[model samples]
Every structure is written in structure tokens, then in C-alpha cells.
Target: MQQESYSQDANISPNNYQLSTPTKEKKQNKTNQSTTIQSPNNNDFYSPKNVNPWKTPKSLLKSNQKQTTPDHSQQASPYGDRYIPLNVSRNLFNKQIQPFEIEEENAYEELLSENVLEIDENKHSSILNFNKQKPEKLQTNKQLENPKRKIDTLPIKVLDAPGLDDDFYQDILHWGKNNLIAIGLQRSVYLYSVDTSKVFQLTQRFNNQVNQIQYTSLQWNANGQILAMGSYDGQLKLWDYNKNAYTGTMNMSSKRISTISWANSNIFAYGSKDKTIHICDIRVPTYSVFQLHGHTQEVCGVTFDGNELQLASGGNDNRVFIWQLRGGNTYADSQYVSWEIKSHKAAIRALAWNPNSSGILATGGGNQDKTIKIHSSLTNTEINSVNCDSQVCKLRFSKIINELVSTHGYEKNQICLWQYPTMKKIHQLEGHSERVLYLSASPDESTILTGSGDETLKFWKIFPSQISNNMSSLLTMCEIR
Candidate 1:
């Protein structure tokens, strides 16, 4: 009856409703019972009351993705549509799978924790028990600041030494302990007083021309009372400084004296172009007291050891000879050649004896060799050698520091300082435009005088003696603190 009543409407049709048989009604009731079964409050089941028909489907949402399209104005002029697939799958996968981390320790922190843990624990324990150990005010141990010992290589004073002969083999400059400097200029020898800063002519040529009577060597006695000068005319002259007068003259058998070194108060040794080393006693200037004959070429350099019993000589024959003195007044027969060094490849002109180490001797070679060799007298063996990279003109050992100084001749014209025994170069003094021919150190071991072939004399404060006082004061202040 209800289906016939609903079918009477124009919109309702009898075909839309089926007559309810007993089995159909029971099946329909069973379907209604299953549909009416309540589900638990979970989002997995789709309920008609909660479902929105107006919402977009998941498939439609996937199809309509928010794409980042390039602007048409920035595209190429052609109008063909191009779709480029993003190649960021690996990056996306990596970002999605990567695990999150908090923080990590660096290598230094790990090393400290592994090795210094015990020390750190001990330090912490000490700090915790510090109050119990001492009740005094907290204080830190002050560090002593040592003043740096610096070499001021700049010339403190530069003076024009006119008419100075540019001879590498000649020793024409000497600085005395009395703050006096005697330099040979042409045929005249000039004396300079460092205290008064005054220079005066000590001697001049009497008959010979300036070129023929050039002074080749100058030396001061240990007491600074007398000065000895050797001339190219094969003559050696003595001057009394206090008296300011020429005392005596000795003739060398037509041989030019290249270098001179004082052995004692009354005795001095000189090297000659005749390949001979002669020792002269001022009391007897008529003849040499002793003569050393080892070199086969011109003897260019000579030095007396600290004890004055050993003499080192270098010559143009690339040889170095060490002679032993008889300690007292003796003739040529008493002195003998102790050793001969044949290590140099060229002429050997520079020689020096370490004042601190009595047995150590240093010799430098000429332009062809450019090498400096150190020999031990006791061992009679070569101890060390250094390649100067230039002609070595002169070598001097420091009295206060365990170091050595050298002047170069060709190419470099530099003065270099080196550590003793090790021979490590400490500093290089550079200023002279020409080859440095002569070098002298002050008696106080604080200043150095250099003479170059450019006819100039430069005074350099190479060592600071006041640094010792500053260092001592710093140590005392630290101790007091």
C-alpha cells in the first residue's frame, strides 16, 4: 500500500520500488541491520554524516599539483611548451631518511679528554684543596720578561775616508782600545779620536809619490801606546801615540806587507807578499826575530792566538798554516809549522783565532772559493766549514757572545754574523755598495767599524751591552714580585 501511494506522484515510479516478498523483506532487513551497525570512533571508516561531497578527491588533488612554472617572458622566444622533470630525487630521499643529531665533539676536545684527563683531575683536586694548603692571599708567579738582544746594523756614524786604496789584500784600518782609530789614506796615515771626534794626520810621505808610498797595514799594540804601519814600499814603521812621534822603521827585503798582528807588548807579526810570516821585536828592528816559511804564494792574512804561542797564516796558494811559537824570545829556528790546511780551492786571505776557544782557528777563502773553514788545534782537524756565497774578506769572533762576524768581498759586500760552533747565520748587515775590505770590533764588544772600497767608513752598533742590565733588572723584579 505504501509503495502504491508513493507511485501516485509524478516523480515517483513503481519501477523504482520493488514489492516486498517475505524473503526479500528479510534480506532487506538484514542489509538494514548490517548498515546500522555502529563503528568505533576512528578515522579509517568513511561515514556519510562526516563525508563532504564538495571536497576534492585525493586523485584530483594529486593530478592538480602546485607546479613552479617559469615565467613566459623569461622563456626562449620559441613557443613550444617544454616540461623538465626535476632531478632532485636523491636529495629529497636523503633529506627524508637522514637521522637528526644534537651536537658533536671536535678532535681537540676528544684528544684532551683522552690524554690530559688525569692531569685535569689532579689540577681540579688541587684547586679544591688550595684553601686548606695555604691561608695566604692568592698570587701568581710572575714571568720574567727578558729584554731582546738586538743588532742595530745601521751606521751610527759615517765618515769620508778619502784616498783609501781599494786593495783587498791590505789591512789599512785599526781601532784601539783607547777609543782611537788609525786609518791609512794614500801616502798619509790619519789618527781619529772617538771621544773628541777629531782626526789628524799622523804621518805623510816624505819623498815618494802618493801611489808609491801607500800604507797597506795598520795595527795598535795591546796597551794602545804604540801603532805600527806597513807600507807598499816594503817598510814597517812604529809610532809612539803618547809622544806623537815616529819611533823607528824596519825594512822587509823588497816585500809588501799585507797584514800585521800584535803578538805581545813588544813583538808583532806580519805577513808579506814574499810568502813569509815574520815576527819582529821592536827592540831589534834591524832583522826579524822569526820567519815562518810554509806558503808557496803571497801571504795575505795572519793572526796570533789568545796565548800568543800559536800563529795562523793564509796565503794566495789556497793554504792555511799554523805555526807554534817557543813562548819566549826566539829565532826562526825555534818556531815550527804545526799543521798545514789545504782545503781551500782559491786564495785564502781571511784568518781569525777564537779568543774564547784558544785552539779554534778560522780561515776564509777568496773569490774562487768563498768558503770559511774552522780548525781545531788540539785535534788538528777541520771542525766546521761554511759557504759564504761571496769572497770572504775578513772574519772576527765576538769576545762577549759566542758568535763570529764576516765581511764579504764580491757580489754581496755584506757583513754576516754567525753562531759559534754551529755556524748558523744570525744576521746580515748590508749597506756598502762596494766590497768590504776591513772590519774591526770595539773593545767593549758593542760596536763594529767597517771600511769599504767605496772610500767610506761606517760605524755600526751591532751589539747592545745594555740588554744584559735590562735582563738582570727584569729577573730581579720578577723575583721580588
Candidate 2:
């Protein structure tokens, strides 16, 4: 009745509203509209169960906590079960997550919970061994070799020589192989024994002569039985210290015999101021066997090689000559002069042949030059040279090592030890107060004797005594005079 009254009052059109819809149908349509309004469009909405598993779980949780409901909360309350917050769902969908961290944590936990296998130590000891090996130590040659130390700076023995000459060109002191020292004091030759510490005047008979000749040079033969004394009068006096007798005296030259060097037990050579070199044999006590003339000034230095096969001579004429031993008249006109060197600017006096090397010679220059030159006589070439800084008075090769010991004069009256081939100076000794004029080594070459104008004879231990058996045998076989 109420529906008919409202239709008549509004001038109801019965054709348009043919039949009234049911109340149940109208309520169903109203519920559908409310559901559509509460839920968002399908394109913008997402379900929690269908969310990407790769997204960071912490971001999704934070977005969900930050999300707020709209002011129409009561309207959407009935369909809240099917609805999801747009911010939370969109953040979880848009974000990227690192899967490795989660996987690593899972793997570590799995490893900690895993069960490890066990084995009996005695049953598999060899296969499960963990011992380390210890290596053996090695020894070096330096550790096994002899213990050698540096030489002392002071002389082991010092002696007084009241009348020793200070002349640079003359050699007046020599050490014989028998351990005796033959030293000339002014006009007399004295013999000093190393063992007994005794001195004897060998030229006692010459004390009576009015015109006593001064000793210029002294050398002992290879046998160590005869001592040859050179004088300013050109006399080559021979003496035997063991017998205390004068063996003989030969007139070798007209001027002073400045230096003498023995070649063998019976043969020797001497240089004189007459600028000549003479080789003599003991059998002919009055004459020389071979004569050599090359120097224009006084011959001050002469030495035979290691094997006594060749002779090297240095002269005041600044010349050096190497001669080969040959018998006169053996060949019709054969020359004994093998080579000559004029490398020195001043007089050349100091000369020494390397006892260990063949054809190796060391020559030193005088005050004007002040240099040491090494030469190879085999190749006829100058090997090396060094400035001595002072006058080179004498040079001698060391027997225990391949070295050269030199004495200096003028300024810096000192002795120097040089390493051979390289010509490097090793040590310098300064005990002399004046010019050092003489140098002679002991029989073993472990010690050297030096004489200076200060009237003192000093002994220095220059070489080591730890000599090899081969070197000892060689020294015994060769004279080294």
C-alpha cells in the first residue's frame, strides 16, 4: 500500500516500474558496490602470498609497520581480510635483495651442525703424520781453513847499526837461506846469525887497508854457503860465514857493483856503475861468463826469474832490459837481448820478479817518477802501474802470496805491501825516521828486514806462516835468491 501511494503522489508511471524488485536482490547489489569501493583496482593491488621471495624481508616488514589506514577505515573493515596496504606491497615488489648473504649464513649453520668423522691415532699414524723434517748444516772452506790474523805494526826485533849507509842506489843488506843476515857497515861486511844471535866480522882482513872500499851491495848464493859482497871498487868478494873464511874476490868491473842477484847455486849476476851486467860462474872466480851492455847509466837493479832462465835489469838511465840466457858463440851472431822497456821517466832502481808467476816483473821508479809499474815479460807489455807518492827505493815479491812489498825514500820513509795483478796497496809501515834504503825478506818469507838512514834495522812480519806444502817444497827446490 505504501509503495502504491508514493507512486500515485509522484504521478507514477506503471509502465516503467512494471514489477517491484525484491528486497533481497537490492541488498545484494548494495553489498557488491561497497566491496568494489573498498578494494583497489586489480592493476595496482598485490597479494602477500604472491610477493617476490628475492626482496629484502626487512624492507617489507618496515613498510608494513609504517603503513596507515585511510580515514574511511570503517567502510573497508568488512573486506580487510582480502586487502593489502599499497605502500608495503609496492616496496616489497620494487626492491632488490642480496641472496648470497642469506645463503652464506645458512651454509655456515649447516657446517656447524654437520657430524665429523673420527680415526684411531695408532691405527693410521703413518698416513696422518704431521712432523716436519730438519735439514743438515754445511761447512765452508773459510771455517775449515787456518786461522790467520793481521800483522803487527811494530817490529818483533830491533837492532842498532852505527854506520849503515843511507844511499838509495845501493843494496847493502841481504838475508841468506841459512837464516843469516849479511849486512855491510861502511867498509866492513858483518854476519848476523838468527839462531845464536851472534855477529861476526867477515871482512876483518880489510881493516888494515888504507883505501878501504865501501860495500855497495850484498847477495847470498842459492846454496847459502857463499856470501857475495860488492864494493865501490868493483870487487865481488865471496865469503863463507859458517867457516868464517874469505872464499875469494873477483874484479867484476871498474866502477861500483851497485847490485847483485844470484841465478843458481854456482851462477849469479851483478850490475855495476859502468852501465853493464855480468853473469859469472864460481868456477871462474876472476872473470864473467856472459856480458850484457844496454844501459847508458849505472845499472842499479837486476834479478833472475823464478826458474833462473831470464834476467831483468833496471838502470839509472831510465831503461829496462830483459835478456835470455845463452852461451856465447853457441850461435854465430845470436842476440841475448829479448826485449827492452823505457817506461820510466827517471832512474829505475827497484825491480822484482814474481816468484809465483813466470815472466811477471814489478819495477819502481826513483824520486823524479815515483811510480810502480807491473810488466809481463812474456808478452812484452806493461800490465799496470800505481803512483807511490814518494821515491820507490826497492821492490820485493812475497813468497807466501802473489804480492809485492816496496820501500820508499825521500819523504814518507815507509814500507808498503801491494796486492799483485791489481797493484792495490794493502798496508803501509812507518818506523823509519829517514829514507828507507834496503829491504830483504827472511828465508820463509814470513818476515822482512828493512834498513834506513836512521841507523836502525827493523824486522816486520809481513806474510802469513800458514804456507802450503807445495809452496814449501818449491822454496826448498828453488834458491829464491
Candidate 3:
């Protein structure tokens, strides 16, 4: 696996194979009994770079860029004594592509939510919304507070295989306090510790095709960290990451569990491909606590509001459902609670809500055009939209300054920042030549981290407040000149 650092185009779609030349090629046609030669603009699909034969790294990189368990075949911890068997996925797309690897195509092929409103529960539905505060402009002395790259933290290896397509497409990374995890094709889950800079595997085999992963840990019930994996197999598995052991696994449906989110720690909600959201109680250790069935299509993403309470789900049914954690004692006193909401145009892929804004929800558009749309979950309404580099693959809200972190589809690799109402481009976090897969914002909102097909995770600190001193000094120096 060769290691390379490349910049990403923030906004680009998966199907749109961007070659060196235009894809609009003219063709000879007889439309009205007249022969005409079409132009050459339709050549975007067959990227000339595909034929460059330079996809490999300049240097023949060795696979041992990062240290790992020597076997390479497979591994398990001491818990190996007990192995709970679950249904293995047999999908062609999932079985063929191995993890930590990639096989780029010829580069010719381009690939390509919600509800609301009104009175009667049966008739028409309405949404609630509100605009947000305008952000300040970019001050001087940007170098120190805002360094362009964090080379010290970026991964140096490249994982190659078929589904991985490009390394940049695999950049979206997730981390829990001490570890960073990359969610990839098949059941491929790679874990990296920020503390040690070492990487390892979480699951040898995926429940089916690994789509997304959400980490949850609540001190009230279990001290162990639980990972809710939404798989193409239409099942969800909860594994204790700290123990490196599988705790519980269930087949939610035959389709994928599009998204999973932790309500707190013991309580988590999962949206499914079958257009349903199931809220499970980790404490119960027996059955699902509650379920919301309103969306008619596949449920895409799920998130829990801050303050440790509400549940929000987005789906292909074009609807977003909101559920609150009521304190009243239920029949079983379980972690189940209940709520509802508005609709979307196409299927909803990823969603994020502002913890500081009292339910200000930012929904990123999926499907064809990746537009970032914002709405107030409290008062449902279309507030505004942010134009991304390409079709968006994922979007998240920063916990501190209320900023947003968004990752577009494979073709677009750069992560850009936008200040509030003014909608200004604050900074361009560059570096990641392949498709970005997973991304995460630190709890304090000062750092942004990402993982990609390049087989590594990188971290960047948001130079806003703490680094204000250096920026302030630069502004003064410019005035004297």
C-alpha cells in the first residue's frame, strides 16, 4: 500500500467520472432529415487520466507502512472462546470487495427526504423552521490558528480494492475518545488509536455489507463502548469495542439499517432500509424499546438531539420523524420514549441537529445533487441552503461554534467551512487524494478529523478561539505596512 497525500474536490458525484477532457462529445445525427455532427463536450465520463497509467504511487509503497498483527489472515482477542454466529451477507457487491484495499475502474463510468405540514394526522402536514445568526469574517494571522494541514496526524498507507474505487472516497472517519474507526465496504471496519497512532481491525466479517457505524457509551448502564453497525444485510450489530467482543446482534429487517444513533448510551435508535426506526434499550438486554412507523420508504439517517433526549430520523419516504424521551414510567420502565415531523423531496442520506440552537437541524441533500439544507426541528421550515463542492456524502454540525463539517461524494475530497448567514468560505481543509468515507468533529468542535480510501485518518484543529492571540498579532502588523 503506497502512501500519498492529495487534495480532494469538495463537491463531486460518484457516477460523474471526471476525466481530463470534457464529456460532451458531438455525434452525427439525422434529426429533421438533416445530418449534424455533435460536438466533443460529452467526454467527461472517460477521464483521460484513466489511461495515464499513473494511478499507482510514484514510489512502490510497501504494505507495512503501519504496524499490525502479523497474521494478516484474521484475528480475534481472548474472547475467541465464544463466537456467536450471525447470518453472513451474500450480496455480490459486498462479497467481492475486500476491505483495506481498492481497485480503480477504467475511470470512464460516472455514477449518480421527509415529511411535514398541517392539521389532520391523515390529511396535510406542515414543518417548523428559522434562520440562524451571521458569522464573523476571517481575521488576520490565519497561519498558526488555521494551519492548512495536520501531517502529524494523517495516515500514510493506501488500501486498495474494487469497491473502494478511489482512496479519497474512503475518508469519512469516526472516533470514540481514544480510537479512530474507518467504515468501509463489506464488513470492513478499521480502528486507529489517536493516542498510539496504531491501527487494527474491529470485525473480521461484516454482518453483511458494512454501510455505517455509530459509537455509543453511557456511564449509567454499561461502561463498555457499543458500536451499532448498519449493514446491507438489513441487520444491526452492537459490539463492545473496548472488549473487542460482540455483545448483541439482531436482524432488524432483510434490508440495511441505514443509520444508527445513540440517544444517550444505553438507549440508541436505528433507522432501516424498510422505512422504519427502532429505538432499542441496551439495559434491557432483551427486546426493542420503541418503534416509529410513518415513513413509507427506506429510512436513511438517524440522530439524537443533545441534552440527552430527543430522537430524529430521516428517510427515503421523504419524511423526518422526531421522538422525545418522556420521563413517565412506561409499562416496563425501559429507555423507550416517544414523537413526529415533516417531509423531504428525495431520500434523506445524512442529517445533523444543532445542540446549541434548541433543535436547529441541518439536513444534507442526497441522491443526485448534494445540497446542504437547514431547518429548525423546533419550528419546521426551510431556513437556507449551502452549496457544496459536489454531491454531498455526509454532513455534521460542530458542537462548539455551530459551524458545519460536510463531506461530498468520492470525486470531491476537500472539506470546506462556511460561516453562518453570510455563507462565506472560512477555510479549505485540504489533503486526501482519494474518496473520503467517514468523518467526525471533535466534541469541543475545535478539530475536524477524516478517513479515506487512502487507508488513513487525519485530524485538523479548528483555529478559532484558543489560537486567537496569533491571528490578532498578524492583523496589527499589516496595519503598520
Best by lDDT: 2
Which stretches of model 3 miss by more than 4 angstroms? 1-173, 180-186, 205-224, 325-344, 410-413, 430-437, 453-456, 463-481
Model 1: lDDT to the true structure: 0.78
- The worst-scoring run of ten residues by lDDT in candidate 1 lies at 36-45
- On residues 1-481, what C-alpha lDDT tens digit does candidate 3 reach at each position? 0011111553544323222211345332233122211112332112222222223322324443532222413323223336555545435536677576546743333221122222353655446434476667766797655455332233333333323323211222455544444444444555655557666776555466445443221111122276666566666666776677878877657765656667666887777667777778877866487666667887767787776667667766656666566664344422332334443455556677775578677776554545677776566566787667465556777654546777655457777666654556666666776655456754445666665566555667653434256655866888865
> Residue 243 error for model 1, in Å?
1.3
Residues 12-129, model 1: lDDT tens digits:
3212322212333543343332221111222211222323323444644567655343243532322123534456765675675767684985778778766975445344445355
> What TM-score would every model get versus the actual structure?
0.65, 0.67, 0.54
Q: lDDT of each structure?
A: 0.78, 0.79, 0.54
The number of the candidate with the highest TM-score is 2
Q: Give the Cα error of residue 98 in candidate 3, in Å.
A: 99
Looking at candidate 2, what is the lDDT of residue 402?
80
Task: Compare candidates 2 and 3 on lDDT and give the better one.
Answer: 2
Residue 153 displacement in candidate 1 (angstroms): 3.6
1-112 per-residue lDDT for model 2 (tens digits): 2222123334533222222223445443432433222112221112232222223445456565543333432222434467788999999989996575443446555555
For each candidate, how many residue pairs have backbone atoms clashing (under 3 Å)? 0, 0, 82
Model 3 residue 108 lDDT score: 30
